[model samples]
Target: MDIKQRNQNAIDLTFQNVTVTVQTKQGKKLLLQDVSGICKSSQITAILGSSGAGKTTLLNVLTNRIQNSKKVQVNGKIQANSTEINFRKFSEFGAYVMQDDVLLETMTVRECLQFAANLKVQGDQHEKDKVVQETLKILKLERCQNTLIGGQFVKKGISGGERKRTSIGFELVTNPSVIILDEPTSGLDSFTAYLLISELKRYAINKEKTVVFTIHSPSSDIWQLFDRVMLLIEGQFIYQGKGNQSILNYFSNQGFNCPRLQNPADYLMSIMHQNNKNAQNYPIYFQKYDSLLKPYVEKEIEQGEKFEILSYKFETSFVYQIQQIAKRSLNNVKRNPILFRARIIQAIIMGLIVGLIYFKSEGRSQVVFFKLIVQILIYLSKDGSNHPTSIRDMNDRNGLLFFVCINQLMMSLKPCSVSFPSMRKVFIREDNSKLYSPYAYFFGRLIIEIIPQIISPILYGLIQFYMVGLNDRTVGNVFFYFLCLILNSLLGLSLGYIGGSIFSDVKTAVFMSPLIFVPNALFGGFFKNRKNLASWIRWIEYLFPIKYSFNAIAANEYENTHFIPSPTELLNLEFSKWECVYILLGFIIGLLTISCFCLVCNRKRQQ
Candidate 1:
């Protein structure tokens, strides 16, 4: 849709007598009291206020991020294009960037921009790349296009100012008409801050995008860039009018003389103080100021000049988000040779360890070591390695192994522990674009992760099973053990993915992995026989993949022993080899299904 066609004069935004009351330790605190205003596309509105003036809260209300509490009632109307925009759909029309920078650290500046562009745009690679490069030049980040962004362990990107610009760049890729940022110039030097504000001013003027952001005491240079100014005090709107003149006029009418050769930002801060001895005590100063500005704001609304704007419909597709995310993941994997090198090294080391440990043991000891190998394989399913270094850096390792085997298993069964907590960011971004179905991402992750998860554990089992010298007749038994390990890995990955989605934070996701493994470990017949164990434990064992895996491996190893009859006879235990295989497969499928369900649920929650 063209900008002019979408920009209807249908009340772009209106706050009708909205009141927000928050309960604090002090008592019922009225954070916002009967506040009302209108934001139009043709104008850049600034929500200026001192700290704790409810400016941020007001913006949150506008974006629908904050819910109204019992004490905090919103008794008013919020209209966008004559349609009531509640908290749920507010994001569909506008973009809101909080004060904090939340970009991925591993991605380069160019990669970050490209990924965002890919998600928002529907075009060939050439078109998407062209848009991304254009956005980089606009944000003045072209110099550091190859630099990495921020994270806890890494800071390889440009300065903080550049990071902020990158965030704006991401939003701009979508070309939303309403752009709201909270303290965009925060944490920057004066010169850089001024330059950033100037750039935003240019964009507003040239592009006709409504820019609304909260700022704390801006410099005069920065202040001049604003098209309009809003003064908020203690959650109440004191004044909303044309830039510096609003501040000058408010004080002039109150009989306060403006200081010569002084910054207006400082002057306003001085006047906004409630406890200052020199503070003016004009009769009902706040109430009178609100009364004076009300008529002008209402006049702007009535004139049909308030809401008219260009409607730009940017269609974002699901295939694009999936393709972008997938491409990014694959590129990172390809670029970082160390990631694969480590996995290969891990597989080799595990093969050696298990091979050497079980080299030449007799009957019962060999069976015992075989079970040990199975247990090791199960542990490997969680992380897909046996080396000390692999175990140490397990949290940072991101492969299909963790996604399909470890994460998926936990999320499917426990759901509380395995999923990535940052899943919210992905969900929010995807929902905004109306891109890929939740199932697509989930299934894609599962498919991508399985190879890595399956290969390592299977290699370890096979190498060890053969090196330890199993009877020639029991080759099929060794194969069964390998299948069991593969199944367990799939189970772990499925649980882990679900856990990661449920809890986005790594610490929490890792913390909850064992919670899921414990039941499987116990029920898998680790410490006791299933029949001898508690009735509840036996019932639980039926659901644990480990039980079938362990049973299959044990039957394979012990079947042809002199103490036992024959391999065929051993296979006739309570559960046959096919029974074990089916059970293991069932466990994998069941956990995966649940993980997919959780992903859908989580996506809905984000929407």
Candidate 2:
């Protein structure tokens, strides 16, 4: 197969005097000032700068990742040949390897490559496997093909250098015309960094792919691999052109002569500090160097303006993208057995604990039932924290009596509630690929997560309901209680998912989840009489799944009791078991609906 024939050409990127500015609280800040450069097919361009030199920001401007900011202003054209490519269009032409390696750590090396291949190409299983194998070989990761990449939980994969290579391989599988990588050599030793740059250079020359990446202080070996270099200083383009020899000659012409024993990388670092008060002598050196390069920079700009656009065509299918995403998701899940095992263990532990707490009750079991209700309410509302002093004494007394009594509750809720933020990492990876529609992902999660939660809660309810020594209630009542527990668990899962989605970090999410649960638990009729609650608070009860679930469970438990009719005497004062079932189902459906709506809104905002 002719790879070059299969690939798209006519891909030339141009930035004409592109300036990016942002307004900060302190004042206006310039991220990129009148910077201009070109990236084209068949060449590798290295953007060289020190830390905070705005190289990444320039890339963001070229890719259209930056949004409108009061402090941000752009005044230049970024075009692909004749067609002006905005951020979105630029995104379509290339894949960006961000500074941070964001990958599914649970996936193995082979699985990760296959996942990318599936997303980037369409073919039979055999063809896809071949692509994955070839990519792994290209990265020299064949030896660790089956190794799981380290995550927070699992640390048993390739080294940092290999991980970076894996990231590049993912983008390469897509066959993007231009690959933009940010600090690709980051975290790698000098030898590995040299090898990585050499590999990239060979790939660009041999395969005719455009390689654009940023590097901070490259070693001598790595520097020799670049065909072109664009040097940046304080958000300005200090230099842009071909060859390390030319760069050295340009500096020497300005009388900034290099010492025989001095490293070029170290010399450049000193030049970058010319503006600092401590580096007074370097200012004179930089002035001479800057004057010598001014003419060359002007000539490049003139040549850039005269360049014409090239024409090319690319072949891709939407269906192919979808199939790739699905395969990747499935393979990733299979490769990470620890996650599956963790889910199972959590289900079993929760089931045993809840089951032991709520065992069955005998005749006139209202007191025992009330105590069980309070415990459930407390557990749902609080995050394993000590109950307040007001409630602590009552809890201790209840424990001593072993009999149920009405308890007054008073506790200071924390500013934030416990939440699982790490789930966001999973959601983000899935969300970015457009793997499944928002609804599909939501439903998939519902199916996978709801089952374990339902099973555990039901097992607990069943064990507790019978062991507490209830009267001769039908087996149907036992099932009804289990249904209530299942609905409650669904409610919790929905809340957790929503919380995870809204917050970018786990710490913030953890703090927020309980705050959300507190109001739901309060209005669920666990603490106070639903009828006697304040009118406004009573309105909140209608919106809470726990309100209905608690009511359904309580009504089914007290079905045999009699109650007075309302003053109008027009409606039944007591709820039937059938009514309880309907209410529980309604609550579950309502929460699920809201969860789906939240997800849809979030997806739109992201897009």
Candidate 3:
């Protein structure tokens, strides 16, 4: 269906006898208690409440967003067009704009709407673009259409008001039957909030779409924009009726009058405060609401025509989902180059220092000091063919190779640890909107992250290869060495991806890296010979990526060796060079699969 057809499917939403309770240590605590209300099509309904008044809880219950388990119970019947509906059916007709704006900071306002259109709007490219343009005009965001959504780190783009409007436009592109926002006016100045509310009221009237939102601290002008108002206190309704003089009259008849020249919203909020003397009269107000208003609302809720709940089908293909996700990720990478630039600089500096430290030590004793004369003589005389590989030389070579493996692993791992956790909220919000599947997101992000993982290792390998005098200095050997380094880096990156997917906090992910890496390094056959460890524990070495990577590089280095002591035999590594390479590839795939599994688990937890 096109935008007009979808908008014409406007629905009247009703929730009845909704109660939410959480099992606490002491007892079950109620968040919302037997609340019932009807939000009609083509009207703006406002849920007003003070802090801890359960306004958001009621909204969540109506939208079927609250997670229900044994510890948390939700008992409610939500209807769309008077037909009982489940969460999936409700989500098909409704779009929720969250309190915090979750736009991709690198994307412009127009691009943000276009992305939603690509995923949600039914049509081809031209049709989706038309919807996006229409949404831009409707939201009055045409002037800043090309401006970025900007976050804490990115360069400034739009103002907070524009960002909020862009967020609204994102949902509007789908032309949903019902739109609900949680605290849309939050964090905006008085004038900006007034303008936003005016736009919302106009949109509701023009489109005939049901609009519902929770608000706090609305000025008198903002309050007057609502077609219907529902006042909540301590999880129960104190008032639910028309927003004009009728509400003032109802409260006045109860001996709580709005003073002249005072904002009605302010006066109402003051009385709703739990600590106010007016709060002691809440019982009387509740009795009056139950005696007078409950019957009328229940009757209105029962009048809607039955509607068939059609399942929502995604408009975009899987490949197109990946394509769009990757495009957004690339835009983010281009704008936020600080991390990538730092990784490059870190590789260059570390490679230079490490290569110089191990410079041409193949034939020399491990005790070679930095004396000028001796160093000059060694530089002139250093040749692989001059001296056979001694046990000491084998030990030194193993040391350098092990160091390279650890360096690539840590360099790749540290940065990726924070990547997924930082974007968790954005992913969850978009996932709830049904933009794409977890598999699409996983592969799309991996496609972009692999580029840097490849580039950094190649740079480090080129710098350290010839300088360390590894494996006869032949092109074939250099290629193999570089290949091993790149694979190790990717394996490290996969581990990092797994770590980030598992944790929701950056600090926790970083702190746990050493705890994971240190044990793996110990069993990697460098610190302790695997032959001497207990057989049960020795199997653990096969599980870590480090063992295979170090083994592969050392095997490649010592392939045609002329040493008296064979390093491979001395180290007791039984895997052939190619076998280790295959194992490294397996580990990379396995780790990535585990990361995707973790991402799926995270999604389930969010639901």
Better of 1 and 2 by TM-score: 1
* Alpha-carbon TM-score of each model against the true structure: 0.82, 0.79, 0.93
| lDDT (CA) per prediction | 0.62, 0.59, 0.82
Question: How far is 423's C-alpha from truth in model 2 (Å)?
Answer: 4.2
Tens-digit lDDT string for candidate 1 (527-602): 5555576665456667666666656655544443444233324223358657878877876687778777766776
State the displacement of the C-alpha of residue 350, model 2, in Å, after optimal TM-score superposition. 5.6
Cα lDDT of model 3 by residue, 447-557, tens digit: 988889899998887666556666643445557888998998898799999899998788998988887678778888999999899987778887787998888988888
Give the winner by TM-score.
3
Off by over 4 Å in 1: 1-11, 69-75, 274-283, 304-320, 334-351, 363-419, 422-437, 471-478, 558-573, 603-607
Of the candidates shown, which would achieve the greatest lDDT relative to the real structure?
3
Q: How do the residues 1-607 of candidate 2 rate in per-residue lDDT, one tens digit apiece?
A: 4544434353556677778888889988888877777775567788877778888987776665666656568778876654787544554556677777767787777877776666445567788788788778777888888887777766776789888888888777766667788899999999988888887887777776778888888887777777888877768766677756777776677666667667665676667653665255445543553576656655554444223332222323545544444454455446654544554455455444443453321222332433655444443322211111233332332231111100000010111111224544445433443333556555654554455455555544544443443321444554565666666565566566666656657677667766766776566554556667778666766776555555555555434433222211211123554675676567557656776676566642121
**Model 1 residue 503 lDDT?**
63
